[model samples]
Target: MIEACQVNRSTFFQCLNGKRLPKESFFEHLLRTLQLSPGEESKLRKLYHIAQIGESVYQNRQCAKKCLETLAALSGNLIPQIYRLDGVAQLTANWASLEGDNRVFQELCHLVQAEMFLPEPKIDLFVPQEDSRFIEYLKVLYRNSGEKNVRLRQLVQFPQGRGKKTRESMEFFDSILFFLASDCMGYEAHYYYSEVDFADTVGVLYPYSVITSTGVLLMNEAMDRALFSAAPAILETCRTQFEDVLCKTKQFHTPFKGYQQTVDFTLENWEGTTMGYQYFATPCFSAYLTRELVDKYCPAGMEERFDHYFQSIMAGVFYVSFCSEAGLMDFARNGLMNEFPERLVPPLELEDRKTVLETMLYRPPENSRLYLMDPEKTTVSDEFVFSLAKGKRIMTYRKRLPKLRMFCFQEQNLMDAFEDFFESLPESSYVLPRSEVERVLRQAIRCCEEQMTFDLSNQIG
Candidate 1:
């Protein structure tokens, strides 16, 4: 390979190790560098494009295998247009509505530094920032995102909601044979009391947002700080609230199976002092409203008490995540829905708002808190998420129409322009097994984006 490249073996090996990206002009050398088969050059070029697009979307070992399969699909041709974006869906609509106060949005704007990268960069739309602190901002923001596609400032005003469309063409000749792409966009069951929360589908409609009930408090700092360790105490103070609901209903179902019959134990400190842990089911708002009573007004030794149990309770949330690399989604099959293969996000056109509503697909029982149709009996479907009725065309509720169309048009144009312009919309996607984790990430990202923006704006002021 080295001799074919006209470089010594050492230099050739260096490029292979990622120590160096071979100069663009040298791409042709690859034909001989690896002693490729006939017509391999074009295929290798297309693969590079795929890798570049995917680098932003996936970051695990499984992603690597998916990439290889994509390369194999091309069969040795550098056909850029050899791919197709025809079926690709724009998932970034309303995602671009950069709410003025979103921190993640500000962080991305600050981190990208268009002024530094582009000639005669317009500083007008840019936030005045402390360049020194901006890098740190990216690190912390990325950490909280758990390697998922939580766009910056997107929470305050999502591009789709804000009338922006996904403007990219993530075309590849053929999608790989793997389903890893669908890992994002679903809820995790472990977080809720169990999948039974909506009969198992509570998350499908209200999602963790159900917890954002009026009385739930929002304490921003406690979460932003590496305060993960501090939450257990808060949970200890709030455990009874969860238990009380179960006790009241006379069916305290735990996500952990077979424990329904386990004798309930009143939470007590090491000294055996019984304390009430009831706060609110929706802890984000609960934390906000109860901040003074919790973060500030810990009952005497309560802060010193229940610390251990608090940790255990938080763990029960069972947090895991997957992110979108570009602003679009690709699903040869539905990974989130265990019963069917479908694209969770629907594709939108230039001026079309394709409101995406993920139905747990199965109706829950009347007494079901969440939409859980015994997994033993229920199944996922092949129904496309955006096109719930692409073929079947069932009537969605009247209320779903306004926001539904609203969600569609906002993303349609943006989706059109982005895919056309950027060649792809890399989705930083996420799938949460625990509603709490899903809830917290959504709220915190919103808050963090808002906080950073407000803080930066203040500094500029």
Candidate 2:
């Protein structure tokens, strides 16, 4: 082949042995002489570029790792190709274009089917729940593969309130259950209802490989590009983020029979479990607890029914009391006071209220110790009194809750900083013993009752 290409055998051998690098011109000429196909030639060119980068960065560990990642990605059997289109109308056209490029579709199908053949296969997805077509595609893929063992982990946005788009969001949740019920696929879905919305990127992680895209490929809202990689570092990073989000979000279970039926199921199975409950004054929190309390306690008897109803009504009031004078009072007054006066008549901050709520909710086992860090005068409510009477643990700080600049568990420095901030709080901030809590709560409630006169008959009515 070298002779035919008019190249010296020694020079050709040197290039082949990696002792020398070949110019693009020489590489093209070599491909031509070997009569390589267009696809093979494209792969070779990509490989060459990767090789050049690898050689330049060989001495720098970090740079070398990156180079190696690029090389591995280019060399993989499934390299994602970018398809540019004008708008949503072009999605069908672009998909038709992909029909001619069976390699991409086939690779995706192979990954989906891997769950059936490979032992303990896992797939992770980071995506927007509003994309129904993507969910449909997954359903079709799972149905076609007939694989029952594939474990799917997804990170999806669950909007915080029943706003204009709430119906659409609820439909998406229903669709998830529909997909799950269609097959015996082992799957877990995490709902991220945070203040920060992640970039519209979809990532899929398999046991041996990873594939990521700019947006839902089945939809036409965002970029139509993807990246496929077998690089360990890249895969690990994707896996880590998927896991971090999983750790920070709530696990959503399938509502098989119906929404109300599922509620009944949860109450039956989860009643009396010591849950570390965190309350924040959000429509989502109010809606969720109302259903939970009603479902769990209303079914027991008339007395239990009234208790749960009263707790549900007071939950919001309790949250407002905690927020008052901590900087959230104005927000509560302006946004929620009128509509929820029965609940928010007591009125509320620190940093953004959402951030405080998310931080409090996401910080697990530690959340069992309720943090009452409102730097203002201690305000107690019926709910607070009831919680203390029920022996719930509490923690208090003289200072308000600190704003977390960053909350990435993977970054050791950030984790260390978080720990330092938490540990630095004065030990005196810890709440007194349970007996003290009962005493304080009782006195506060008595004071409140005396200050706010009410007809005793009205409560019975």
Candidate 3:
């Protein structure tokens, strides 16, 4: 700031952080020195707030870790407060797992109390909850944990005992969270205690609820809501549950079907590959714990795969540049993706984006840009998008008539791109083409606009 404004360092730095205003003479000198425009000033203001928030996360690291430590120690029944304090605690747990901070973990555990006592805070649930049955199961499971088998069973049976299966400890987190997050047609609370076998893999129970022609938009609208509401929870639960399974499973009755066991990958044309190991053994369990052991005790091969993730994300962008030209990404499919569907625009500050744009209209023969420019080569493959993360075909369609194949190519590119983008970041916010890194935000804005339109239309009608 000082160098740009030709002002003294102290005042310039202080001003940026909103610490103190410089003297009029200082301000005049600084303003003239910088030659800023009104629009630039506004952008700078926004950036300043973002930077502040980033700093706060750094500061709160210890708090999140504490939350998690608390969670691991808790053995009592589930408190209703768990539901109430859901958001912030969930955020902290996820942050701790990814960032490895005691503060966030501690904050995660503290959530049990927060939800019980604190009024719902000033935030929305990204992943909406439809049925409370799963929450009920959670409550039961929490209470049952340390009890003798008989007492544990007795505790769980208290929640009306209508659910079909005895709440397996695994199912407590899996079936419960999945049911809460997903809305399968044939699957219901009734199905849980009954004989109906609705097919789903991992935790998801896919319904035969087919979207009709007239209901296409309706399905999309409902989908947007469900995904928005449950995404955070889904991601968080999956991380915890799978990591727990990975970390603790010396012996188990049920096999660890890879995370994408039930999803079809035929969309990208890479359909036949059966993913027995990677998705289940690692992807679902220890994303942050990469293969190459960093320091002393991390996973092996994490660092290598991270590089591949970057390549795939760029491949996603390359596909977007060719298919949409405008850099827009479309919704891929259900049960398979963690990110909202949309293409990422490169940021001005990003050297990668600069390199991409430089080669867009013209580039050397061997350049990747030349390959991306090809409509044929650039097209997303049915095998890529439709195929499961490890190449399995989805056996069931949850919502839409499994309009699964129409855009599998883009979705595959999207899936890998997201993997690359997310895996590379230190925190969720770094989960940007990041807001910090993204130069072009039109794609995100478009999603927001579309969501608002659906909301308004629903409200008006």
TM-score of each: 0.19, 0.30, 0.18
Please write out the lDDT profile of model 2 over residues 1-461, one tens digit for every residue: 88765678898999989899987677878888878888988788767865865632212222212221232222212322323222222222223222222333343444444444555556776545554444565665555445446666766665554331233333443455333433333666666454333344345222112233211122122313333444456556766766676788766543223333323332232123232222222221232223333343233344453454345444322321222222223332232221121221222211123332343344312213333332331222211110100112211101111210100011122122222223322232322334442343344333334333343446666
Better of 1 and 3 by TM-score: 1
**Candidate 3: how large is its RMSD?**
24.9
Candidates' lDDT values, in order?
0.25, 0.37, 0.28
Error of 1 at 375 (Å): 25
lDDT of 3 at 159: 24
C-alpha positional error of residue 458 in candidate 3 after TM-score superposition, expressed in Å: 55
Which run of 10 residues does model 3 get worst, by summed lDDT?
A: 277-286
Distance from true location, Cα of 334 in model 3, Å: 32
- How well is each residue in 1-461 modelled by candidate 3, as lDDT tens digits? 56756677787878868797555566556556667798876565545544545543322332322321232223122244433323244332322221222332233234323332323211111111232333453344343232222100111111223221222221322333222222211111211122332233344422211111111000111222111112454545543543343343221111112223212221222223323111110011112212231222212443443344433333332111111112222211011121111111111222222222333323422212111112221222211111123322211112122211111112122233323322322333212222322332334334445555676899999
Better of 1 and 2 by TM-score: 2
Clashing pairs for model 2 are: 323-348, 324-348, 326-349, 327-349, 328-349, 329-348
The CA lDDT at 224 in model 1 is 20
Which whole-number lDDT from 0 to 100 does residue 346 have in model 2? 21
RMSD of each: 29.1, 24.4, 24.9
**CA displacement after TM-score superposition, residue 157 of candidate 2 (Å):** 1.0
